[model samples]
Target: MDETAHALGASRTLWELVDRRAGLTPDRPVLLQGDRTLTFGELRDGAERVAAGLYGMGVRPGSVVAWQLPTRIGTVLLSFALARLGAVQSPVIPFYRDREVGFALRESRADFFAVPGTWRGHDHTAMAERLGARGVFEAYGALPDGDPAVLPPPPADGTAVRWIYWTSGTTSDPKGVLHTDRSLIAGGSCLAHALHLTADDVGSMAFPFAHIGGPDYAVMLLLYGFPAVLFEHFAMDTALPEYRRHGVTVAGGSTAFYSMFLTEQRKVPGQRLVPTLRLLAGGGAPKPPEIYHAVVREMGVQLTHGYGMTEVPMITMGAPDDTAENLATTEGRPPAGMEIRIVDAAGRPVPAGVDGEVRLRGEAVCQGYADPAQAAGVFDSDGFLVTGDVGHLRESGHLVLTGRMKDIIIRKGENISAKEIEDLLHQHPAVADAAVVGLPDQERGERVCAVIERRPGTGDLTLATMAAFLRGEGLSVHKLPEQLEVVDALPRNAALRKVLKYKLRELYG
Candidate 1:
């Protein structure tokens, strides 16, 4: 990290960081959305007023508030307002419906809830009310406003669990990953420093702000004093003009994002998709080596992919100065404070160049899951978080992720539990057995594929029917299977008779 960013990153709390940045560069824009701009000073001032309004609404320090909103300036203000009030804030993705939203509210025990009312043809407020959420309020256009004087002192402690993010971790339901302000700062700081961003660089947020990457990107902007264009709904056609308007120098979200831009670039053989775009960098799902080479060769820009998750947003990130071979093959190296240890199946540390489960010990690691039982056996005795990802560290220290030990499918950087989908599919009367797996895709990073064994004499099933059934079962739309294959029987082990998912992947992938 640079000396100035390192010093700014030392702030104890996110509120402190905001205050300090506002004091230094209050007039500089921190967030840009269409014709709207939120300066650093306005962010601090607006959040304070919103905090006072929330205080009047009975929110106190340690109060739990859950919000399900899109990528808008108002959502940012609301989130920072919760921070200013020292309230525990949980953000749910906008696409999440009753099942996921209800799970987040119940698990977080949210005292209050924030919704966008109705967005993208969906009624969020109605969904919240239907789920029996407490203290439901809409936060779409204009946020609550009040005098800043009514607010209490901003939080001083940064180690307290203030953020609850959801992720499917080898389970049937999403787990609440607990995080502290300091831990998030550490994660974002690593990302900012590794990317080597500067004040002159213009960034773009083309993904859901409710994801863990929201705070991670916000911290980067705060530290580097840069502004990023916020996209509520990202589509290639709609976002191209905005990128040009904002002069986006850095663009990317994951492998999917890179492929989208590359596809656009290919539309015109020699023309740049976005004239100002210079670097495309992100990480969530695995990046195929060809995607990296294609972006560099075809897009005429730098492409860097990394490794991250909801538990730890920035683990290792590819730097702009890294060798092309390293950038194409590995996920890059960890920052100073992060410790990556690859271990064998027996839990013994393995030497470099050998594949094993990747474990991490770092300040950026989350406090653990909200459910105590879910956290059991998550961290080893040495305090390293046992990441279910299997990878190896090269001699140059770049990490190469081979595969995952967990049964989660990452599609467009979102973790989808194969078990969750399979369990839901098993409930169908015509289905005898089901297995879900992720297949390689150039655009989505991975596409969900469900292979099923039909009950004898049962009619054949189509993907559309299976999807409608899952939707009726209250499963999130994003988790619905994209491809379906009917099989006579699922391949199984001879001894235990356990379904072998690898065989399904080989057959369908």
Candidate 2:
């Protein structure tokens, strides 16, 4: 989960960071790619020019411009240009397939679309051509046709619509989350503070900028006049050198990638890698206690656990200094200017000990979901966003997320949780990535089916093997997966995390 991208150095708006840096570190590199660098001044100038071009295209105040691209100078500049126009910029990550992408385009009603011509393997130009958008600006190409820009029309938080983002869905239908111009400014501030990023802190983004994590985080660092190492693609081979070359002081990515790096026991031959990095952020999936313990012991960097979604945005983040247990067990407590509650089925707040739906209320929350009726169902009577996850509160007073209320499977008359099975499966040495879903059973209402990706080069993790592993650990016969599907790699999203269970269901079930 990421808030808006604002500066932490002082009380400054997102624009103020660009303004200050364009003056202080005008020659300092603001963005970096393979042998390509854009100084702060150049970035500012390019953005203004691009904003002028966008204005020529009639992208005015409140217009929704959806951008889909891998990280690049163009992506960053165009984002700034859109912000300059007071247009709510929505970034579409690469992880989304056409189904998800088409859903967001319709729900956002985006007037202008920005994308690159080509990426490492994906074709951005083909996607742009397929969409047939009204105001299409290929960020990757040259658009010499320009005009002087005009100031945006009178500011209004007045329901003109903002960024319509899609969160990981429970059902097949993806959740369209909305955020306003004002909301982005307000929310991004939380990230700036929590990370303690400074102008000297060069951030290397591992995730795509379109998602809440990358650009939003980078935008905040940019606002602080820090150099941002923009990776066109998330290549670990490339990421390590950039970390050392750019002197990136802070770096982070999703839990899956963090696990990939840590679990592999990566070694660098030279001096200390990424010596300046102070913060390492991991989220997007449940972070097992063992993963966090390993990261702390090995990386020797502050681990920040963030909990977020496109719908609820960044709800809770476990700060580095908060405590080791908080980082391991629960998502951090509610941030400032936010309220959280554990509610039962009747929409009533339950006692702290009992597990129920997690509800949140804050400026950072989405304006609403896509459909009005659906929005009514998602938002509570008192205007709290209903997070479908179920969990209990320890006496220690931190959020302990257990499982999604919607993903819970019913077996015979008993409700069986996939999270319980998945967590137990993760403790095994062979299991790398695991997902549990209910399979139809004529006898028992539903039977548990576990789909797992084994550690690289591992053999087939059939039902018999899983059963033996579970039995050796304990005799929990009922909780075992009736079926197991072992694959090479688990499907992930733009964040290089988030198992696309919906896609898996469509592909397998």
Candidate 3:
């Protein structure tokens, strides 16, 4: 990690650019949270007041502030507020449970906590007391306070740990990924170029602002001098109306949100409220090809898929002009200002068409993990972040992800990824969703297990039937699942998205 950093502007931080934009696009909509709305100027002013308020509460620069808020106007302000003051913001996802929340708060050693006075109909005042964070501040609304604001001076010529975010603990303990102000701004630029965003565009975000997806995308729009409509949740009934109301052209969210929107469209035939909507993008997990087809065919909106992680957020994204094959298979090529390589277990670069661990190094990549020991564990001798994903990069610079290095199913001798079977499960007409995982077995170290969610009124999601379908799909004998669990819905996080295979492993495996 270099000690010095500089924003591409050579003189501005991300918040400074956003603050400048607030004055440029003063009357334009900056955020839309249920019944509430705020323009760019209003959002900036609100963030200033909130920053001032946080400062009065003794939130000095370099303070680790834990923001435990849901998606909304206030959440956005708190993020920029902390950034503007040079305080590090560690966000607790709104859907986090006691264990997850407690772990993050304690591990981050937060100096202050911010939350909505009320969230998702829950009283945050009571919730914060239970969570136990210092200097709890209430984010009421986008109103200006007459109190004097305290703005922290910039880092000594070269520093920016503006925020510390962790991975969505799908596999192990969340790795704290730190981003400097310069790197965060660079990340937004990479995403904006890949998405072809412009100042004339209007974006509607559904993924939580606390994570990489919303903050990166929202910053891209704001930095490019565009307007954005922020939503606190992914309620289809409300999201559709909000998009139509704001004439939003870009719809950003997770695979779960897009899947739910498709499900809703099927239920309510002939509902075209947001006809002017142009694009729909999904991330947070590998998207099944079927859902991609339905979104484009039915809604007549361009369907874009993104693949990234916390270590090197925005690694690969499907460009606006990528071919269907490129979009469906690879996660598009590495965006500008990024470099990628496929290497074997020994860390030697591999030839095209061979699977190996993917390593990435670039401006978008983080300097190191927050935990020194964790950083030593993942960082290689050559200073590259070893992403545990098993994939191959072609000569054309496109990548084909075979599976994850850690998610492979080991049978008697063969190693396999559950993604192949999950893709096959999507081929089933009655199967709404599926996740394949490896379960311990007495006979073979580990065996395959499939957890499936069947559509309403659909029956016969039996283990034997699914096996037959896999066989028909040409799955090998050893690759077949030894057990199947059909349920009304798979267990998911607060976002109502499923990827917690570990949770299922505890329940059924």
Candidate 4:
């Protein structure tokens, strides 16, 4: 690790780093939204006051507080206040309903629950009460406030598990992922170092602030003393003005975000999407290489994709200075202090360029799942967390992900990579987005099914045309998708905008 990163990693806790950054640049803006701006100095003072109020309300260190609020200035203040008070916070995505929200509150045993009143046409306060949540209170425009003198000293330890983040839970109930202050800081440091960001750069947060990326992105802002715009509701038409208004230099949430920007740019051929957008970078779902080449060619911006998950916020990231082939074909390289190991089925190390399960051991990795029994099977004997992802490392140290172990389609007892076919489908001119899944088949055991969202104004896409396109692209005959389904939009999760493959299987199977 570099000296700057090493220093950031040494911080005892998240609030401590906030204090350090605020001390250095008290007047600099840390967050921007429309006409509102929150400076470093205001963040410190406001959070301290809110902490005092919460303390007065009997919220102390180690208190379990669950908050489900939108991405707004008040939400950030509440989160920082919890950090200042050393409370264990579990952030629930605002879009979650009674089923997921009830599970999280019950699992975490939260003592206090914060809701957003009536937001986006949903009555969260009533829902919290309906779920029998304890200490349910609305925290929106007006947060609790009190005298700062009543607050206790901030936490000194950074290694304690103070965060509980839930997974998307596509197959089953969500798993609570345990995280610490140091781990989140380490994850953000990897992103900041790889992106080569500076104080002059402006960023945008289009995803939900309750997601893990909220803290991960905040750490970068604190370390580099730059500002990022917050979008409570992000859409292509609505969000473009905010990006241009702030002169955002770096923008993107994930693959869906890249496609959205490209679509807008196509409406006006010669015009740049965001005048100041020089780089489009993010990672959550898989990135088709075609998207990389198209963004560079049409949008005239560099696109760098990385690999990360709920367990590890950042594993690998593509650097801005890397070669074009590496940026498009590989999920950048891991930073210093992060170890990437590829192992065979028996847990033996595999040779470079050989496909195997990807495992990780690093400061950015989560401690473990909240359920001890479930955690035991996630890590190997050597302490590396089995990522459940199938990939290989290239000779250049870059990571090449094939697909998920469960996502591989079996046809005639032959395993085929769904991601491989999906990547090839993305290169088709008429195909806007694609997802591949395995469907039950008596003859082939499991057949390949392709679900695609067509580009606007495009004619109906047929299975034969898609098959011919894949064949022309040099795809293997056995790997071709036998079934095709077209739709106006692909189902996606609200947080990372990742396509929900299970939903597709349920709808088409």
Candidate 5:
């Protein structure tokens, strides 16, 4: 990495880093949506004006402000405006409804709440008023504005908790993950360094701007001085033209995104889907090894998957030059200063190649949850955060995830990994997507159920056919799926597009 990029990791505050980058590349585009371009200089000047406006409304340093906005230039300006004032900001995903949004607002005790008014046929302003939210206002078309002289100096301390990002509530209520400016910077540094990006490369943000990745990606752009295209609503047909127009070189959100791009490529065989695209990289969901090979061989683009969560946005990432085997089978290696520990049930460290709970500790890790009660049981004695994922580290320091602890299915006292079966199923020519879930059963304790979305133009797939395919792949007979259900599509969330397994269990259990 270059000296300027390395120096970004040492920035004490998010606003400071923004200022430094803007000064270096004042005229370069920092954010783009449609025809609206936000140059580095405009980003700083506009945010300060909005900060002054917020200050006029009695928002001071350390004040709490929560916003649920879509992916737009206005949203980016509002976020930076809050950072300029050093206010504690809580960003809720635009797709989250009352249940999750109410919990976040109440728990965070936000003094102000910003919404997009009417978005995607939903009236957020009405909901905010109905929920009795304090300081409810719209930030879609235009944000509050005032004189910059009214604002105080930007915050100097970076260790203070200023960000509260919520987890996706798949099985239960979400928890608010607390973060500092330094932690976000550290996480972004990991991603920027691993990708080996240059200022000339163009990126894209297809996911929600409210996600933890929003700030993580913005930090990378600030450090590397590159611009990224933002999508308000991302669809394959509509997004391709914009990507091509801007010459997007790096594009990906997660494994689902990779699959989508691959599917598009298959439509017109022997033609590159996105001609300028060279790399597909992201994290947030488990990637099947076969999917990696398909992208590299078919699309002719390098696929480098990674491992991360809301608590720590960027944990481990695959580099562009990693070995094919390592990139396919492993989630890549952690950068310098990140410590990954695989521990047994009793909290003892396991040997390399042994599957266990994944624990992480580093500058990038979140401070804790917003609710103190929820934070009590998350960290180990040595300060490592206990991640519920089950994975093992290879001797070469690469991470190999098996599955989640709660995702393991126990049938007749034998444990079965859902990810293992899902990975094998993904290799099938007829299967477009598959999720293996355990259902309650009186005879075997729990029965293995395979829910699949078949590829277009494929014939019906019965339980017998799936079982036979698994057997041919050398899967143990005991691990064979006992039930099968083919659906049009798998249920997924808005951000990261991760399959909502809990919803699948609700339907199939």
Candidate 6:
């Protein structure tokens, strides 16, 4: 990063970062949505007005406000407005319904709630009323506004826990992940530095603003003084036009996003999907090596995948200058000050290249879970957050994730890696997506099961054929899936669309 950006990154709070960036380039655009554009000056002024209106609604410093709004310019304004007031804000995904939404509101003890009213044919206001959400109000079109003069000073401290982000709950209610402005800024700085982005680059936000990535990406734009096109709903058909219209150079959200672009590029192999696009970058779900090769070879863009979670938004990120071998096979190296410690079952440190639980210590790590009980046992004696993910550090400092600890399947007394099989399965011409899961078994404790979502115009993928393919790919005999089940589409959460493996286990097991 440059000295100016480095100085901006040091701002004490999110609102302070916004103010500094806005001061340098007040008229420059920071957010774009179709024909609408929100400049840096407007972002600062508009947020102050919104903060004043929120204050009129009895929202004071330390007040908890929960918003379940889509990815839009208005959402960003509301978020920063809350930051200006120093309010503790909890952002729930817009697509989340009664169960997830109610859980966040209750857990945060929100003094106010913001909804989108009836969005995508669902009445969120009615649902909030039914859930008995306090201080419910709609924030779809015009947000609450008042004079900026009435607004109090922006927050002075950035270390206070002011943001509550929920993890997508598949089996149980989501855990409230606590974060501060400095932690979020550090996470975004890691991502921005790794990507080597510049003010000339135009990015795109195709995911939900309620996601933890929202702030992560927002901080990038703030630090670099660039603009990103906002997509309330991302679909190839509708989103393509906006990318072209705004000249989006950096575009991606996760592995699924890369696959989507590759799928589109395949339709017209001779032409680029987005002529201005040069980089595909994201991190949330696992990225298969085959997918990386397909994107680089077919789509003609540098594909950089990273490893992150809601707890830590940017753990490690693949740089564009990384070797093809490393880019295709491993998640990129961590930035300075972000510690990666691999530990065994007994919580002992393991050497590089050994598979173990990934423990993290960094400025980007969250404070802990909202519930004290949920936060218990999350960190080790060394104060590193014990990520449930299983990965190994290469001697080159890159990260290679095998699979989640829960995804490991022990069949016939032999532990098997689901990602090992799934990564190989993705190379199959007939498979669009595959999930390897463990099913309960009386004799062996658990049996390996492969769920396949076949590619278009492909024939049936039988267990025998899948086994033959894995064998051809050099998978060991004991690791072969015992059963195969085909599905139209795998279950996924609204944000990031990460595969809901727990639901698959519940259905198949």
Best by TM-score: 1
Q: lDDT per model, in order?
A: 0.93, 0.67, 0.70, 0.87, 0.88, 0.88
Tens digits of per-residue lDDT for model 6 on 247-321? Answer: 999998876678778888999997988999999998776666888899999988899988888889999999999
Global lDDT of model 5: 0.88
User: For candidate 1, what's the RMSD?
Assistant: 0.8
Ranking by TM-score: 1, 6, 5, 4, 3, 2
Q: Measured by C-alpha RMSD in angstroms, how accurate is candidate 5?
A: 11.0
TM-score for each candidate, following the candidate numbering: 0.99, 0.74, 0.76, 0.81, 0.82, 0.82
Specify the highest-lDDT model's number.
1
For model 2, residues 1-509, the per-residue Cα lDDT tens digits are: 22223332232334545666677667888788878899988876787778788888888877888888777777778877776567876778764445456666776778877767666565766766686655666777564235444545333332344566655454434566777544554455556656656566777777677776654565565556667788877766768777888777777666655655553344742334467766777455566676677777777667777666655456677777788878877877666766778888888888877999888887767788666756777777898888788876666657788777677554432335576567778988889879988665433435678889899866666799888886665434555778788888878897868888777666665
- Model 6: residues with Cα > 4 Å off, grouped in runs: 169-171, 407-509
The C-alpha stretches of model 4 lying farther than 4 A from their native spots are 1-6, 406-509
Candidate 6: residue 243 Cα off by (Å): 0.7
Tell me the lDDT of model 6 at 177: 94
- Per candidate, the number of residue pairs that clash is 0, 4, 1, 0, 0, 0
Scored by lDDT, model 4 comes in at 0.87
Better of 2 and 6 by lDDT: 6
222: Cα error in model 4, Å: 0.4
Q: How close to the true structure is residue 446 of candidate 1, measured as C-alpha lDDT?
A: 90
lDDT of 5 at 477: 72
Tally clashes: model 3: 1
Model 1 misplaced stretches (Cα beyond 4 Å): none
TM-score pick, better of 2 and 5: 5
